[model samples]
Target: FSYCAKDLGLVLLAEIDEAEIFKPIAQLKNQIIVISIIISSIFVGIAFYVSRTISRPITKLRNAVDRISKGDYNYKVDIKSSDEIGHLGHQFDEMRKSVLETNRNLNMLVKERTKELTDMTNALDATAIVMVTNRDGRITKINQKFIEISKFTEKELIGKNPCIVKSGYHRTEFFEKMWKTISHGEIFEGEIKNKAKDGTYYWVKTTIVPFLDENRQPKQYIAIQNDITDLKNIEYALQEALKRDKESAEIIKRHVEELKRTNIELRRKDKLKDEFLSMTSHELKTPLTPIIGWCGALKTPRILGDLAPQQRAAVETIESNAVKLEKMISDMLDAQKLDLNEMKFTIGEVQVDLLFNKIKKDFEPLLKEKDIQFIIRAETADIRLESDEARILQVISALLYNSIDFVPKTGGRIEVTAESRDNNIIFCIKDNGPGIPKDKQEFLFKKFYQVDTSLTRKHGGTGLGLAISKGIVTRLGGTIWVETEEGKGSNFYFSLPRKY
Candidate 1:
């Protein structure tokens, strides 16, 4: 500093102002401090933004984990960013879907297996003489059929040895063979003769199975048996029948001619009965026609309009009875025709709705008298069908008439419907009446089968309506059946092909 000062100035006294000297230095220092503060602020803002973006998805993932850990496989994270967090969420959803699918599959498998087990159990319970025993051959479980056939009480059979029913016929070796086969996890099948508690003999075709555990050692035994006593009796009878065949040969030869004569007589009698029925039907219908026509004419306003109600009631009663008699005669005639295979039909296209309307009109008065609610429902508008309109309409009318006899005295409901199916038209007649019993339902369409036959029976019908209807339906390439339960109601259904 002394050499440089000597060169720069003659008197290097260092004359300087303290205020101006540090001015630029102080400005630079302030600028550096301001720059540092700005940089720090920018970094702080970036850190806050990064934390917000990163922590939000992490927080959501944590919540999802909590829910999933609580067995909520349906919970999902909503991370949509194109980052590792989004990938994790996607993987998590896939895992959850797999878990749910597994759960559903397991549940379905359980249901299916349980249903199969139940069905198998029910089948075994019904058809077989089922019995279960432990490895020691003590009776553990037995079905009602077993108890019934053995004539042993449940108390006597439980924990009892199966030898209680041992018949002396089978040798001890036979049973030893059976035990040997079954104990070794093999099946033993044979004819078994067991003594009942009453000391009577019964035969059974038996199959004994040894139920094995995972180690392949028998844990228990299951015995299924079928009562073959009848078969055995039949076999014994057949043996006796063979021995008697020679003796019966001469007797059979002697009776053959007589049987032939009897058969011819029977045939002649049947023919005569049919002829008489035809003639009787014709005779009855001829006279009844005039009675019905005249009574109907009298019922009109122009004929007997001024008659008192009670007087008119008598006339109407005669008319109704005559009509029913006519129906019975017609039914007899139809049955005769069917027996002779002469029931003919003029098949043609017919309007079903028109037929229904006509039937409704025919039964309208009777229905109104009975106070029955009658409805005809045509699901297919202006329903046209290719069939014998006359016969089909007769069936409808007969069903309606039959329902009239069965429906309640008042407020009974009868609904008739025709629905057009893909290939056929279904006709249904539903009646709110005392339904047919289950035992009688099978015979409903049989000839001369009536549900009520007591002297005080309120319903009146020839019992030929359903039988004739069934025949007509069969001829028309259709089927008919009734759905009913006692104390409920009856639904009669008939299906006819669209082209018939």
Candidate 2:
């Protein structure tokens, strides 16, 4: 180191230190090391900044993708950045929602389909005799109903041809037609007769439907059956009943013809009987008329010679009985006329008071003989009826005689009254006599009905007086009725139309 300055040697030959010569180089080296350390620290801070902004978000996205791959749609991809990663996270959440909804819909659709199939199967089992067969007509499946109705066990029926239950009633052509229809994939419906294991026959309304393959040919058949055994029997019974009814109708027609002939004969006989009665009554009345007249003449002193008391009494008795007989014949003729509707009425204005007076006068002698009290009460003073005057007198006389015969011999009271009633004139004959019983009162107006049937009874009547009176009053447009109680007296009333 001293020899470098040897040309100027004499002055620099003295001691130079090594440390002082290398001091600046050592300072430069220290400055270079400090700059390297500062650069390294800056690079480390940049790496940390990149990790906070990008690496953490990418890691979160990776974890989200992992969760989504495991079907964890509930986990939220909550990247809140306004960058592509945030958009990606939003799209992934939407996809997860869509997948969840699709899964739910799929589950619902599966349940619905399963339920429909189950219901269809159960309905087939419950209601019908179901049978499934292959194209070869061998039974593959049969419902419980088929087994129960056929009286065949499942073991015996399965894999067997449907001919096992065939009844001989159906011909071979019947089954051939059914199979031909089904083979062409058509449905065949008919009533089938089948024999059971118990040797009994049953009928079924059967429908055979073919399940077609892609080529439109039958691969299998499903035969649905409904038992119609009872219906067939009912149809047969109805046919038999109709046949019997036809026979009965012919018999009834013959009976009706016979009845018509009998009815005609009866009409002819009734007319003949009426004619005979009329002739007989007229012939009998002719003889009685003269007898009644002669008896009256004998009783009169002026017409015939005066007789002794005994002779007079006998004549009077004959006259009275002859009068009774005449009255009976007249009643019979009147009844016959009424029955034939041939009675004639001479219509005229009849004063009710005169009619009553005539009734009182005709019955006066009998009333006096019985010592009965007779009263004539005319509530209608000038009431006049347009009717046959002679017939009115006859009815009044009959009712008066009926009352007089029944009244007490000593203290009998008879009341004859003519009163104005609603739109009519009412004539009532009341008697204080033994009242008719409740049960016999209704029959008092019938022909030949006698209230007093005892043999020892004091009253004597032909039982036709009231009946004839009723007929005459009815002919004159009137109604007759009697009111009587067991202990009370009797009142007989007849009403005639006031205008008539």
Candidate 3:
């Protein structure tokens, strides 16, 4: 190795252990690698510990949130780190419980609402006459009430046109108006007359509701109805009754007018008959006055000439008949004047005693010839009356003559009496005679009215003496009446107002 100074390098190379010399450096390099590896191991261990502390809990929270977000509320955020993450997990769990409670309440509310809707539908089906129609106006559903009224089965009515129940009462324009309203998604309410399956007619109050689509146009229709046929029938009956009443009223008005016209005609005829009777009686009385005067003059012997016995007897008979005829004519004229209200009266005071004496003297001879006793009675002497004296005497004379004709020829009795009573002087002519029948007494004062036709002819009276006497008494403000019973004595009474 130290070989010769071949060079200093050769001698230095003979002293060099290159392996031993590089040993410390190699040791140092190894030492540095080991330290570097140890420090890296420590850092990795710390990193792993930090990730377990922070990232593991964060990952668990994220997974729990993910499950909760997926609607898996049963999953729990179970971070038990005693850090902020555990508190956050507790709050999240509370919020989940609140959300679950809210959901459950909402479900219960939905169930309750659904049940209420079902009950309402059932009630509507039972009570209402309900019908539903599709957009094509075909029947889709109907209730029992609808089936009963329409008299149709469910199978027959389903999918049938609503016009199947038409009564032909509504015109086309009516349905047109209804369709127009519903087509615009409106509600139509109205009364409809419809016919049943059995041809019976009915009325209904209907409401149509249109269901609209998203575009706001009607997609379908539903109808509900109730019966009103009875009301309509009653209205028709009332209209007919009112018409009949109006006709009856018109007929009654016509009959009343006819009756009024007939009554006016009868009044006119009665006035004409009264005028004719008055005119005829006056004409007959004028001619009778002269004949009665001539008969009286012919009976007097001195006025004409001395006559034989038979001639005198003939003249007397003629005078008597003429006097009776003249008296009858005078009575007829007086009766006619009373009917016309044309009789004249002279008012004065009449003395009762003096009037009675005159009547007694006038009828004395006739009373003797008939064998009748004529008696005059004065109940109150000095009796006075406010009346026509001549009319009073005429009334008394007619009654006396009537009695004289009817009295029994052999044993007849007559009395003429005058009396004063309250506010009147009453003159009564009573006689025992064959009295007038009660049924005929009322007609005795009427002109030409006699009790018996046979008795009037036998007595030779015109049957007018009583009529004239009543008319004269009435004109002097007095009343005349007779009280008689068949086969009994009769009393003729007349009263005039007493004037003080």
Q: What RMSD does each model have against the real structure?
A: 19.5, 15.9, 26.2
Candidate 2 has a TM-score of: 0.51
Best by lDDT: 1
Model 1: number of clashes? 1
Worst lDDT run of 10 residues, candidate 1, spans: 1-10
Considering lDDT, where higher is better, how would the candidates rank from best to worst?
1, 2, 3
Worst 10 residues of 3 by lDDT: 4-13
Tens-digit lDDT track for model 3 on 1-500? 35656655444336768899999999999999999999999999999987887788889879988987898877767777777777777788788788778878988999999999989988888777888888888888988899999999999999998889989998999999999999989999999999999999998889999999899987788897777789878987888887879888788899989988888888788777667655665666667678767767777777888778898788778777767766776776677677778887778887888888887788898888878888998999798877777878888888888888888888999998888889988889998888888788879888787777773466667788888888787767788898888899899998888862
| TM-score of each model, paired residue for residue | 0.51, 0.51, 0.46
Off by over 4 Å in 1: 1-245, 297-310
For candidate 1, lDDT tens digit of each residue in 1-500? 12255565665335667768899999999999999999999999998977777788788888988998898888866888778888887788788888888988999999999999999988987998989999899999999999999999989998988999898989989999999999999999999999999999999999999999999999999999999999998998999887879678778887998899999999999999999999989998999988999988888889867668987898889998997788899998998888888899989998888888887888778788778898987987977778899988878877877777788887799999999898888999999988989999999999998898898987777789999999998989999999998989899999998897
Output the lDDT of residue 106, model 3. 85
Which candidate has the highest TM-score of all?
2
TM-score of structure candidate 3: 0.46
Q: What overall lDDT, based on C-alpha atoms, would model 1 receive against the true structure? A: 0.88
How would you encode candidate 2's per-residue C-alpha lDDT over 190-235 as one tens digit per residue? 9999999898999999999999989888999999999999999999
Off by over 4 Å in 2: 1-263, 302-304, 454-457
